[model samples]
Target: MSDDHENQYHYTPTLWIGILFLVLFSISGILHILEALYTRLWFLLPTVVLANIGEIIGWSGRVWSSQNVFANTPFLIQICSTIIAPTPLLAANFVILGEVIRRLGQKYSRLSAKAYTFVFLACDIIALIVQAAGGGVASSADTDGKDPSSGGHIMLGGIVFQLVAISVYMLLATEFVLRYLKDRPVRPALVAAVGPRTLDTRMRLMLFGLGLSTLAIFIRSIYRVVELADGWDGRVISTERYFDWLDGGMITLATFTVNIFHPGLLLGRGNRWFGKHIDASGTSSRSGTFAEDATVVEPKRDNGPGAKV
Candidate 1:
């Protein structure tokens, strides 16, 4: 083992685990692509597929590093790809949040669904750019035998920004849920427009999946922050086990969990809540409000007989 190799890992990356993650991410990506195409969810397709691609490439780098731990190329590839991969997945989550808010009714949320998507997506992009740039700088410094602290600090800044954004997003999501539960009217028209009882079950499942995935990504971000803050020769960065469990395991679980509750599978097809409303002239309305021709008879507020409790 070379002296430079001492900075990374005492042993090579676990080859079996690396191979397993590569296979899993590849399979999940293919399935996501097919599902997105079938459902015509163009907005979601690229973000998720690209994220999966990053995972595939990152794991490949890990496999390469296992064979040649002293190679800067594989190490950089693994670091950059893995760190930036989950970012697009986080964007995908933001995209779906808008659709969810729209479906459930915009009145339940403080911001418009479109606004939520736009703001968060922009923030995610900023984080991605900063992190990628930092990774590049660090890799170059490592190759040239220069100090990498500046690059590490840049990466740490990006991670911290992402952490704050996700934290705010979670808070907004919680508020939306609470508001929906408390203020949503129990009108027959609203119920019919949304869907049958099964739709409710699907919505719950989607929420659960989104929550779990968000938690996983958040945990991963914290781990990255800590690892990077400790610098290259820090205890956390030198340990492969922590990387495997906190970084690889969390991301893999997140990607898989989101696949199971994909928006294409859960929100597409006969879900009236997300369906387009057509005006009398046959033009699709972009305002996302109920169509003029559609009759929405609000339930009467009757305290006399059979009033809902």
Candidate 2:
């Protein structure tokens, strides 16, 4: 490579993108707190927080790399975190899909919601492991030059698997939605029992938010795969500014948007929606026993004080 080309290829992390992701992750923490309170699902909160942390780390590493292109530590850290950030988001999506399936009735839906959840999460876990291992291989190598070696193969295969998983998830989700809509009668069983009504605007909005977020995340993953496809020689790494907006900023916005308009957050006040209950402390409880906890049941007949009791 020419000296001028080498100089141009010198490493520098994008500070602006790093700061943006930091702020985004910070806000994600706030949502995590709210989600914990609203859903009372303590386990979920940490996952969300962890995902945000990964994003923060990834962006911070990018910023460091911008200043010191030769810094291997930050590069390794960023690569690992970037690969893992979406895992938490996938977890969140799983919960949402599960809730939808349950509401639509287990018997009516052909595919098991729980099964889908398991499969999606399992794929994510596998992808994470592969990517993590690949990151290790890349870091331990003597030089950063692209080698069609085992490490590159691992990274490439892991990314390809991630892309496939994301695609399958989208396809399944679309199928579920289409089936749900088509099967839904003008008077659905639950609606008929409760009262006739169109789709609730609030619920619809939550669904839309989830769909949008999922699409954004899928898009971001594809970009990463392309960016890393040719190893370091790829134009994606050199065109740092484009990726800053395309991957970092867009992903941050998507993550925050989904959390803010999550089904539990938007519909929590209603005891009947999304299998949640708002406790006095402002936390949402994921207890399906909301009817038992909140409902006031009256006797069917008083019988005039038991009539000669």
Candidate 3:
């Protein structure tokens, strides 16, 4: 380690915090993979797994940083990883909310269920690209022993855009829920998935988990904005404690919450699109795994008005 190496960080990245996030994300990731396979939610694996992978790599960088605080390589790794880690997770959230709107009633939603995923994911990708560019610039600046404020500003702007997108999504979700409550217009097909009224309880529980995860992500975004607002040397950015609590803590909470109450755990088997079979009774199969070569047959729609739970 050269003594003249530019120190990119204000403080040594905490060893315990890095280990904690790494362990937590690993656990969450493994559990989610098992749940997804059991529930046959292959489509969700890319985004959800990517988020966990990013967190793992990012935290590993921090652990390395603790060993060599002045290392630019690890600094770059952590910067890029932390900034972009949540984007894929946010994509997963968008898809979950989309499914919620679909099951509840598309009439109550401002946009069609599929449209929400398409639109939000596109925007999420754009934000990710901008943040990636910013990270590159910041890393280059740090290596040059120059001001990284421009890169910081770029990253901050990208994060702010993300926050705005999340805010809009929250508003639309609230509107959809409110409209559903007022109109009482749930899809008739959602009547009975297994027992008489298990569908409603399961859907509501999944929605609750989605909501909590989104809120945690929103809060984490705000923390990042504040941390970067003052540039590379900002007080908030300097504080390891703030990073642990606001940054790592929030992501850990969101990941675990979403996984514990995963839609796959509840709604996956019921949705034919999730890669499982649905029966005429609108009930999910007792057990099954999705195979790449297997084809899914959509169950016939039961149009009859069944009583809601």
Candidate 1 weakest ten by summed lDDT:
291-300
RMSD of each: 5.4, 8.3, 6.8
Ranking by lDDT: 1, 3, 2
Instruction: Give per-residue CA lDDT, model 2, range 87-203, as digits (tens).
Output: 777667766666665565443344455565667778877887887787777666624543424565677677789879888877777766664454443224532232222335665
**Candidates 1 and 2 compared by TM-score, better number:** 1
Residue 5 deviation, candidate 1, in Å? 5.7
Q: Is candidate 2 or 3 superior in TM-score?
A: 3
For 200-295, candidate 1 gives per-residue lDDT tens digits of 767788888899999999999999999989887788988888998899899888888878997777766322324355568866544343322121
Question: Model 3, 218-269: lDDT tens per residue?
Answer: 9999999988886676788888888888888888899898788887776654
Stretches of candidate 3 off by over 4 Å are: 1-6, 184-199, 274-309
TM-scores for all candidates?
0.84, 0.75, 0.82
Question: Clashes per prediction?
Answer: 0, 10, 0
Flag clash pairs in model 1: none
Off by over 4 Å in 1: 1-7, 184-199, 269-275, 278-285, 288-309
Q: Which one wins on TM-score?
A: 1
lDDT computed for candidate 2: 0.64
- Kindly provide the TM-score of model 2 when superposed on the true structure, using C-alpha atoms: 0.75
Please report, in order, the local distance difference test score of every candidate based on alpha carbons: 0.78, 0.64, 0.77
Residue-level error in angstroms, candidate 1, position 173:
0.3
